[model samples]
Target: MRTAEEIRRVVRTAVEAAVWAPSVHNTQPWSFSITGDEVGIHADVDRRLQFQDPAGREMLISVGAAVFNLTLALATLGYDPLVHLLPDPDRPALLATVRLGGPVTPDEHTKMLHGQIERRRTHRGAFVDVMIPRNFADALSAEAQAEGVRLTPVRSESGKRVLAALTRAAQEVQAYDRAFSLEVLRWARPPGTTRGDGVPADAYPLRPDHTEPDFAQRDYSRDHLWGYDRLPSATRPSAPGLVAVMSTVGDTREEWLRAGEALQRVLLFASAHGVRAAFHTQALELYHLREFIRQEMLEGEYPQMIMRLGVTAEDAGTLRRPLSEVIEEDA
Candidate 1:
């Protein structure tokens, strides 16, 4: 019920919100195209992490998160979003197309999530020793279920330790592998770099603090001490927090996209409650480790993301590509 120009403006604002969704290494591996009133989401294959994510699973997941943001943004603006996932047969890179439909009132919950889209960040180090509300896990699980994915909290002490040990082993193996190291270094920016994308040095601590069963972090500071020098209070060792796994019934590209949507929803909802998340995705990146988790830890669900969530005082800023770099408007 809107004019052409108004629809374009709505789509444009939606894309602005979409870009804020988190991506692996801040790769921002998705692009947007607006034709008429529809927004097209495409995966930028060139930006895919070839060595680390050869299957392009992570890339699809990133695009999916963007899709969720776009949907939420449009909904928050009172426009019903009609989504078509993987609509094109020959052009597989076209992940989704969202068409704006009838207007309605935005709900309080949708607005709450939309408000946190830009504020949400990926916590790279330890979190404060505080208990997350018991109801939070159930709420987050409901969010994922709505998107057709499962968010399982690793509750058992032994189970948490196993995931931590597997993460450690995977990190150690990847650290020594030249290809993996190079891939990580490629996306790791040194302090003051002009690149708008990639994980900046300041996003992590100069030295990682240990948890009881240590969860290995990705080495953004490979050789140089290129990280934030935190205050003593922030450097105190803390627990690994709540370990959780995001999984899907199948490992297809569509399922990966669903997992990404679930991930962003969980993240935004958690952020709304002042909770932060640190990823331990090393095991998910490795083939054998991922298979082991599927069979043993996840009860046959294909695990997509492994993360720990808790409260943190630190908010290391992240960067994203300018909208001009990622958006294409039809003439």
Candidate 2:
């Protein structure tokens, strides 16, 4: 049992942790509302990427990741989070509602993940010449499975090449398309910016490091000078790292949310072991390309995220909106 003020404090802490979850272009498309002991997670539709993510799949996924973080924060604070996904019929934007109940000892694993909520960053360049252990890989897959998502590591050389080629093709097309380019540029921050809601210039290298298989990265810098000064070590072409795809059985809103939860959980698990992930999601944005991946690569499973995971010496920083900008009070 807990008092009203204690519950309010816990909810506040949870929202603070929730905003740190990664979003497409750091859109942070989520808002929180506290009503006594319950917390409501809402998707901020205005912040959604209209051109790139018209279906709101990515936006919902981002909200779901926040929900996962909120749950972990509650658990770290010694409470059981009772969750209801898409709870209200009249309010479709309401993604989830969490109510903390009962005090219990925080598990070691829960604490480990909670500790990494603010530390993990999305790696953009090549990874070090090291392989993630089999045990850790297995654990990551299991963690996704627990949330009804599948994390399949693309291990074969041919598979890697196919994914890389598709990524390159998508990147080329998106770069040349004016609308796509403008949309991406909108979220890419110039260097020395004070804005805390977009992908920062420091988040990626000035020049893209061409990995062996050459999975292309998003051109956040565009044409102007807007990235970190290249380090010889950081820019050296290296292994493509462990390529993986996150998939779900269905492509519904519910499945997308679950995929996001799985992704955040897996990311936290990998970060706990000093591993980081770089996303190559442009191909997944195209309908035909995504279907090809679903049929050829994922055995007909709907692909949600395509990523490469490995260890990195470079520690990049990410940005998030403050709670004041994202949270609302109940009227």
Candidate 3:
């Protein structure tokens, strides 16, 4: 059994790991509270994108990813995590409370995943041409299944093209909308920014690195000349990578949380193998477009995330809020 000091240290380490989980626009819209043996994960509603994520589904999903990281951290420390999701109906913001249970040795795979919590990054540009390992898609599907989510790779050329077209359409629509543009601007950090949250100016390429079939990226740079100026080798047009959609049977808040957990799990496993993911969630942000994809592509399952996975030569650094900003410890 662990003493109080050890448990406190574990909780602090877990929160530190949890903050590294990716969030939409790098919002990092979650907070942690420690009370005795339990750690609370709460959604910071103020950080939610009101225009883009009015329903707060994406916010819940982001927090759920943090939950996965926290639990994985605890497991790595040899403690079973008892996670209570949406524990109280009256307290919607309290997403989860995790209590340290009996101790057990973490498996090799769990250790591998836990090792990647801080290293995994959300890739934002085209991937190199090298093919991913064979049967890797199967492994990713299993990871999602373990979290009650489906990871479907768009294998057919036609399917990839269709999804790409929809993404482009949505990106164009959002870029032209004043409210959507403003929301994205609010989270797009300027160069040399001291703020820890938001998509950094250097995270994306200065000029759009267009892939074949061309899935449009969010205009984080907007009207300014912001973004990384990569070398010629990195600027060359590259493959769109393996396109996949994460989906669930239901579209409830619970399902969104599951999708987020599954997302982080898949991301960590992929990162462990030197793979990275670039997200194209524009289509999913639009109601009509999301419904269309759900009906036409996903066959009724709600698509929570659209992503392309492959190996990348570049590692664009990300920023996160310091532990002091997000953690609250009981007196």
Give the TM-scores of the predictions, in the order they appear: 0.98, 0.97, 0.98
Q: On a 0 to 100 scale, what is the lDDT of residue 276 in model 3?
A: 93
Candidate no. 1 TM-score:
0.98
TM-score of 3: 0.98
lDDT of 3 by residue, 1-331 (tens): 6788998998999999999999999999999999988999999999999989999999999999999999999999998999999999999999999999999899999999999998998888888897876599889999999999999998999999999999999989988899999999999999999999999988888887888878889988888999888787544647999899999999998888889999999999999999999998899999999999999998899999999999887778688999999999999
Note each model's CA RMSD in angstroms: 1.1, 1.3, 1.0
The ten-residue window of minimal lDDT in model 2 covers 228-237
- For candidate 2, give the lDDT of residue 104: 71
Ten residues in sequence with the least summed lDDT for candidate 3: 229-238
Report how far off residue 93 is in candidate 2 (Å): 0.8
lDDT by residue (tens digit), candidate 2, 47-159: 89877899999998888999999999999999899999999989999999999888878889999999999999998888878987777778989999999899998878999
The collision pairs in model 1 are: none
Tell me the deviation in Å of residue 47 in model 3.
Answer: 0.6
Instruction: Give candidate 2's TM-score.
Output: 0.97
Better of 1 and 2 by TM-score: 1
